[model samples]
Target: MDLKTASSLHRLRLVSAPEAVSFLLLLVCSVLKRTTEFNAVPVMGAIHGVLFVVYVLFWLDAWNRTRWSIGTAALYFLLSVLPLGGFYAERKLKAEAENAVIASRARAESAVKA
Candidate 1:
């Protein structure tokens, strides 16, 4: 992968953790609102909303930059809707990105020697 691809993947990974946390908070707040008088819904909703938007934007960027397969794209998209999916996405993306970097380096090294 090139620098742009690497950068886009990095941004997606960076946003994933916060997005997952916000989603969890939203879930907890919703439960709290139903179970008790405490209302954290508004704050949590706003936070999750912002994170979701950021995640989508980064997702799109990475999708455009990296030539991912349909299954890979589907997995990333599916994770957005499921609770705690962001964490899974983050882990998968980090490994993929690392692999991409290593592959790119290997290719470059071989090209230089050939």
Candidate 2:
């Protein structure tokens, strides 16, 4: 992958974990709101909403840059909705990006040799 594509993927990966964290926190806050006077749902909800938006935006950018298949794009989107899915998404994206970098480097090296 080129620098732009890689950077897009990096951006998505960066937000993935935080987004997942926010989602989990929001879930916890929901339970707390029901059981006690501690009401953090509004704050947590807003935070999670923002992160979810950012994740979607970054996902779109990455999809545009990488032209990922429909199934792959859907998987990422699904992960965002599921609890703790963002962490898995982040890991997968990291691995994919690393592999892309390695392959790109190898191609460059072979071209140089040729």
lDDT of 2 by residue, 2-108 (tens): 99999999999999999999999999999999999999999999999999999999999999999999999999999999998999999999999999999999999
Q: On residues 1-114, what C-alpha lDDT tens digit does candidate 1 reach at each position?
A: 888989999999999888889898899999999999999999999989998999999888898889778888878978987888989999998999889989989999999999
How many clashes in each candidate?
Answer: 0, 0
Runs off by more than 4 Å, candidate 2: none
RMSD of every candidate to native, in Å, equals 0.9, 0.5
Candidate 2 has a TM-score of 0.99
